[model samples]
Target chain A: MSDGRDVRACLGVCDDAADDPQHRCHPQHVGLRRVGARPGGDRTRGRAGRLLQASGRVVGGVSVSIDQRLVELGIELPTTPAPAGAYVPAVVSGNLVFTAGQLPFVGGVLPATGKVGEGDGLVDPAEAKAFAATAALNALAAIEAELGSLDRVTRVVKVNGFVASDPSFVGQPGVINGASEFLHDVFGEIGVHARAAVGVAVLPLDSPVEVELVVEFE
Target chain B: MSDGRDVRACLGVCDDAADDPQHRCHPQHVGLRRVGARPGGDRTRGRAGRLLQASGRVVGGVSVSIDQRLVELGIELPTTPAPAGAYVPAVVSGNLVFTAGQLPFVGGVLPATGKVGEGDGLVDPAEAKAFAATAALNALAAIEAELGSLDRVTRVVKVNGFVASDPSFVGQPGVINGASEFLHDVFGEIGVHARAAVGVAVLPLDSPVEVELVVEFE
Candidate 1:
């Protein structure tokens, strides 16, 4: 079944699906068959699908898959971080999922601290950008926790990045690019979204950067 | 048609359907009728709805009307403000609408500038709160521009309030209350939403506060 290989290839599952009975007839493969059987049925044509295809990693005329791209990029989604406060991490209303402001925490601890652009003694802008990416990953984890799959997302609508900066520092946008670039790397064009990068006085837990998202999902 | 009245009341629209033929039937009214006709149909019963009803303006066991409440409070929505940059004021995706960050520009100019809590000689926190309310109003105007009517909104899912704060300020939540309270006053329970109050170092045009919204609509 060449189509089955295409499915496995797209999802970055096991290449030995044909050899392994368990992988050969997975439910997602069954669903893919149903989707592919229909005429003019391009699974990657929708907003979210279009985004995944933007990576230009197509195989056998099929669009590149998010899972496969992640694997190729050597990226792994981190565990959903626990909330540090009384609030839930994300809320879904209608078809939209809103993530709370997320800090850059790994294994339940902050990787870095202090304001961005404080120069001699504080967090560097480059390091702060990485923190923004980590915070964004936490946001994506929150969305996955709420929706069960990142595949359900149609578009990354907005990204609001807050940077704690020294009064003289004005590179908030450059720091926030960490999150925006990471999103684009994963979702491609559909990941391109409106954004606001603002310099903040301070952040919760004294984080150098915080990121939040508004996503539209099917 | 008490059911119609219930829907109208819940949406805060006018009751003079006959006097104003155009007001007699809106598409949202029809949708609400379908929702209200369902068993245990509480149109304003979710998280956002619960907050709108907290105002306790019930009539005939239905929530008091948003339109009437605005009249009672002498609040009128301001005109939609032009964007200060290249971005559109709002974008509609499926059943969701996302508004760009809005400044407190009344009649095309900011009433106040500088950081919140910069007191001694700058803007007061209290005045900054009012500015937040005005910024929220601008966001609502953007929503109206996209949907043609505020009644189309089913829930205010999220509100992101950014305060340009002095290093010493810690009352970010209290200051953002201006936008939250104003939304509650206008949309009632439907206006209640998950919110993030952030302290930023500066805002576009050096405005004191900026507000953005994510709304779900019929």
Candidate 2:
């Protein structure tokens, strides 16, 4: 059941819970680095020693650069998805960027369809949750496309998640938590955001979930 | 069919179109006073002549104060609805405020409860549009409660509209126009915003529409 998604919301403190399904991250670091450093943190074997790179250092407890954080997590962001219709994938006004609703488009195709629920002709909630994380990752792709880089973002302000449901299903929050927690894992404290999760009848392209983001950048 | 809703999105330039079924507002005023001011704008009956009050007036061709525009449109912001769960109705950071998803609750009750679509046992798209407008207005009430005055708003930055649908409905954008046109009617050019409208399976309290807003203020 492990998605192989790491759990750095608490840094290395919860390394054991990273693969355990029972533990979920809700970081209280508030965009600050963990002051009580663990000294010997998990080091990537082939990151070219990026931990000591100029942009990845710890200073005054500010969080690490998001680019470096992505490297540390062993994740490579995918290409920015193209808007399917009249709208652009994302728009920047002032310091915030607003993204269009994004489906879980992995390599240009939604991974699954149908309402999320138990039983026949339905998508499992666990699968939908994973899709939500992928959808949030796509939103970051859109933001990067608009602002030229992910390093400009200062906060993940809000995530609006919609889960297509079978009407009787009421686990919308649990499904959306996948996106919320993924942000926390990436941005540390700055990833903590206000969110709204809801169930909807259907979505464009019949994708199981749709996600949109409002991000604040410098 | 008129719904007694005004068409001040054009600043009274379309008074007859207010009740005409053929015309819908797509104001281009951009929150500016129509420079070619139509000779006489509509006057209010009991706004205590608020148009000439200290806070309302023309300035460098920006736009009339939102309060003055609301009086001109004959709308009273409804009482802010209580959040249905553990979240507050709105939160602010920096110069912007983000509102929670708001259901079209009139007097603490949903006027209709069903997926929006044609045929039997569905919520009509037209009715759903009006509900979207009401939900956006409710979001404003939450903003007013948090900021003490809607007058602080400088711009309606973005709107995220969710229309509960029957899985076959594709009128989500038309439904959301109900809220969009209403905001334009009240805030002039500043009301224009980037928006994302999506059809979902259902909504909380079985609401046909749920709307949320991101607003920028002075």
Listed in order, each prediction's TM-score against the native is 0.56, 0.58
- Residues A1-218, model 1: lDDT tens digits: 11323433344232223222234444333211111111233434343443343433444477766666555444566676644321235668877788877878776778886777755877888778778878887888878777887777777889999888887888787678778656655665456567898887976556788899988888
Q: Score the docking of each candidate (DockQ).
A: 0.12, 0.10
DockQ of 2: 0.10
As for candidate 1, its interface RMSD to one decimal place is 15.1
**iRMSD of all candidate structures:** 15.1, 9.7
Instruction: Flag regions of model 1 displaced more than 4 Å.
Output: A1-96, A105-113, A154-160, A167-206, B1-52, B55-63, B72-74, B78-102, B105-111, B141-148, B167-173, B194-206
Q: Output candidate 1 Cα RMSD.
A: 14.9
DockQ category of candidate 2: incorrect
Per-residue CA lDDT of candidate 2, range B61-149, in tens? 55576676665655677777754432236666678888878888877778898888888999998788778888988898878876888
